[model samples]
Target chain A: MDKNYNIDEIENFLNQEMSAEDLSSFKERLAQEDGLQEEVDFHATIVEGIKQSAELDFRALVQDTRKAMLQEENTAAKVVDLNQNSKSRVRSLGSSRIVAIAASLALLLVAAWWVFLSPMSPERAFASNFTTPKDVLSAEVASRLEETGFANNQAALQQLQEAMLTYQNDNFEQAQQQLDAFQAQYPNNEFAAQAAYYEALSAINTSDYETAQVKLLDLVDTPNFALQSDAKWYLALNSLHIGNIELAKTLLDSLQSDSKHGTAAQGLLRRLR
Target chain B: METSTIVEQLRTGNQQAIRSLYQISFPECASFIKKNNGTNNDAEDCFQEALVVLYRKVSDSNFQLTSNIKTFLYGITRNLWLNELRKRSKSGLKLVMDEQSDREYILTADDQVEQKQEEEVKHKLIAQAIQRMQGNCKDVLINFYFKKMSLREIAAKMGFTEQYAKKRRYKCMESLKQKVRTEYATLGL
Candidate 1:
């Protein structure tokens, strides 16, 4: 950071108080500048932390109430069960009959579990939870594309579309080639993250899980990668493919609270557990 | 009763409202989890998490439920169970029919995992600091930030002048940031 770098400048950036020209310049600096960007990210973390704290408080309240209710209900149920058991014994429902009934109920529960509920392996869980994002051109991305620059940008967009289509069509090699070409042509393009993601996915499709994992890890480490979470998820899937259970669990656990992937991640985590 | 009333009651920490939620929602949710290889404990835990999610959403003044509360709750519970089912596939559990429609609820497929985790840790640290703070500081900070109240409104609510409220809010936030930074320094996060 420059000696004159004021921490309060981040507040201006965050609060949208910077002039338009300054804002654009700051963003350019943010993209290219290292330490300054880290500072901004650190400050943003505190703001986000404040919000999370409030939400956590609310969640804690709900959980506490639920816990208390469950505890009380359990105690009451235990008393009722005890009374019913003594009453049954007094009514001459012999110990043998009681034991037989208990054994039958246990068998019924086991049979029900085998018939209905069954555990899943982590690999199977991954397969079930992992789905291709239906279209990479999400509504947010589509609207932004309209406002983007032309010429090389337009060509890059076209190449990206082709790569995505080829991947969707299961042409892994062709998709990888198109993505490689796209990245080579526009190494620092705005959509570089998306291209890298598809490249990784293409690698996965071709059963080159190691290459896919590497590509996804690169994206995961890159600052301001637009698809960082998607990269993390694909990386987790890669871990599962390569039998790195601990790494996969770590990635999926981080994603469990994500708005988009929370359910999917939780599903995967449950299996791992 | 109207769903809005139930939501309001929940926000106020009404125990009866919580019971109502459980009574209406838990059975089907438990059944779904059980069929997907989850035990009663798993079902209860999943349902509670779903309720927490719902509570967060409903408590947000900006949120509007497009579906009936029951439908939305069921949707959340079902999504949670399906995810659990996926993880437990080692038990040879198969996807049931209802999962096909769960796709509609996915808002986006992108994430900010590392950054989110960073924030999550800081949140725990910050929450601890807030808990240690005097009640007045906590109230002022919560009102100004979480409740999105203006300084004047906060002042009026707490029976103080706007200037005092503003100063106190700043002081409280600064104290919180200092605590967080100290912990970060110590823990090297």
Candidate 2:
């Protein structure tokens, strides 16, 4: 596609350096000629690839800035810790005048640093408000396992139990595996829906937010899904985690009117706003 | 800062601009990818790709700010993450290598794999061609074309006369064209 236009023409067109007449003609050609439009699109895509790489380079610069800021904060925190520990050691030995003055100065410095540096970021708010929802199967489902036809779903329920236990034991990897197996075996059954919800939680625990979002979104659409409220809550948290503050706010707004999650949703909405 | 101002700052390579944009966009996109079994690094990569897409659109000569920047950014980020997920799934390539599978996974290179491999080769060749550019030629070309620097700005930055910068830029472009032709022919791209 790029072969159709010379580099200079491409550059001129991209930069809007072409004459007004030339620009008009070019736009007309782009509109009328499929081949020309395709060429431009192809060139644009390549340019986009290069630009994306360039943006990463720029992002690296920002990351360096953030890293430096964090390092400074850490160093300051360490100094405060060291000073506090020294103050304690000195107090245990003797309440010397010199140690007293040093401790006061150290405390003053720590206060000053805290005052200067502790502005709350949206990310911090998200981290503070977000809690992983529990993945336990319902007692009703567990009791129903003894009935006929429900016996057929017992293996899936057992798998769910194992998955929940593994999750509680912090064996998230195994929990994810068990959930996956349960879902596959019990597809189209209620156990599968439960497994999918747990699967999303397992994914979140593992920081696999994409898979978790997918599963959660699907669950939200399911008819009379038991975990729908929990799914919506976590989905909102997922939005917050990924820095979509507006989306998080919107979701929380919707949930503020929800009977079950309304209180938690209202609390989060205040923080977000 | 205003969105337009932030966009302008980004065009000029401002680190603070990137930081502001990152704070807004990274969390949601990162979470999306993470939920999809992507690592933080994978999320970072996808977010960067999405930013680039947005940057290109924003920096276009005829571009207009029709949508809210955040909405536009989120849309692109979602699409990019989804596309990346699809690609990873199709290829069965984990963004983060699975050590357990790594030991057992021997790639059975089919036509699709071969084609992908060849495309990668061609990409590298194109990159090499750009890399092989000499001195100010590379700098001038990158500044003018990629960085969208004006000839005068390039001249000032390169400490060369504007005429010399213009001439060198054309020469550098010609050299790139020649290199592309040669390399593509040699590599059968």
List RMSD in Å for every model shown.
Answer: 25.2, 22.0
Q: Kindly report which residue stretches of model 2 are placed more than 4 angstroms away from their true locations once superposed.
A: A1-273, B35-38, B58-72, B89-121, B149-162, B185-188
Query: How many pairs in model 2 have backbone atoms within 3 A of each other, for residues 3 or more apart or on separate chains, i.e. clashes?
Result: 15
Query: What tens digits encode model 1's per-residue C-alpha lDDT throughout A118-199?
Result: 5667678667766665556434345555775665476667667767778778788898888888889889878777787888
Candidate 1: residue B42 lDDT (0-100) = 90
**In model 2, what is the error at residue B77, expressed in angstroms?**
2.6
Query: Mind giving the per-residue lDDT tens digits that candidate 2 earns over B1-189?
Result: 578877887666664466577777678777878898889888777777676666655554445666567766776776666556656668644232123332122333233667657655555555555656678676676566667778998899889999999899777766665666676577675
List chain B TM-scores, each candidate.
0.75, 0.66
Q: A246, model 2: CA deviation in Å?
A: 26
What DockQ would you assign to candidate 1? 0.16
